[model samples]
Target: MTQNGFEKTGDDALDAAFAAARAARPQPSAALMAAIRADAAREAAAAPRAARPRPAPARASTRPWAGFWRALGGWPSAGTLAASLVLGIAIGGQQAVPLAGLDILAPASGPLDEAAVADLLPGIDAFLTEG
Candidate 1:
């Protein structure tokens, strides 16, 4: 047993094989080493060049409204705002011009009787009942 307490089986052929392996120091061939170095150099050369410093883009407009336009999130946001404004005006001024197809979503014509209300909220009656 060695200092690590590993017990070797007393087989002469196996012991010889292990000793041979320990004595053998395999090394890469010179040609193989050269090829590897060449590949590494080639890869380093082919690597993309450090990004070039880009010139500051030219401003398309210097008008005062340009700053306001940017603050309002550019043209896309302006389009959305215009649409919302138009929709708000249309809905707010419904009496002036009725929106088409809005009548279908209107509430039913008759008054909400007790039976109709009960049908709408079946659990409400139980909730109101005292224990």
Candidate 2:
């Protein structure tokens, strides 16, 4: 089942397209590769190093909105805060509107009946109708 018995050879380790099978030849030491590595190391070591130019310092922003950015770090914009405050005031007005003259809901409406609520509710018609 092996194609040229290369499968048992494991991976593509010996699958050099241009080279003949090892059974027909002998491997040699990689003296050529060693010479190439040494040459590259010598060239890299002997090369003159150039100093990198320092970058200009970051300019301090004078924009008025910069303070707002610094204040919240990354909070919502001023218009958003104003809009939220408006929405809060609008919703708060609903609850406040239900109250009479900004006074307490209890005293302004009068005291609760001391009688049990069940009795009052069940005989509500009679209690309210009767003097």
Candidate 3:
């Protein structure tokens, strides 16, 4: 339809129905607009307000810790840094697993056996079998 990308139906029956409805719709009278404008004028004249000064713009912080805190960028980035540090400590200390079957899948690539996976994640078997 129109600019929304759907096809516009050009049926004569629907067009006649729409034309009838458009002719039947109620229209605003000139008296209503006159009354609305009077009410708006009355309210504006009744309310008296004091003149307020504009606030001064904020300046950047110059403290030593301010640069550090700004670099951290608040709690979301801080939490991300803490999570990355914990994961780094966990993965960094893990022992490397030795692969044996290097010719099964590819001539150079090693086999991904159970022992190899166990060496990578010790309790993976227990976790997988816990139904």
For all predicted structures, in order, the TM-scores are: 0.33, 0.27, 0.31
**lDDT agreement with native, every candidate:** 0.77, 0.65, 0.75
Q: Judged by TM-score, which candidate is best?
A: 1
How far off is residue 76 in model 3, in Å? 1.4
Separate clash counts for every candidate: 0, 0, 1
The weakest ten consecutive residues by lDDT in model 3 span: 1-10
Summarize candidate 1's per-residue lDDT along 1-131 as a digit string, tens digits.
54235345588787667666656968889999999999999988887765545676895797989889889999899999999999999998877766786654444686556665687689878878855
- Best-to-worst order by TM-score is 1, 3, 2
Q: After superposition, how far is residue 89 of candidate 2 from its true place, in Å?
A: 2.5
Clashing pairs in 3: 1-6
Model 2 misplacement above 4 A: 1-51, 54-71, 74-76, 94-110, 116-131
lDDT of 3 by residue, 10-121 (tens): 8768766766766799887899989999999998777665333456667877888988887889789999999999999999899966578643434356567777668768
Ranking by lDDT: 1, 3, 2
Which candidate leads in lDDT? 1
Clashes of 1: 0
**Cα RMSD (angstroms) for every candidate in the order listed:** 16.4, 16.2, 22.1
Off by over 4 Å in 1: 1-48, 51-55, 96-131
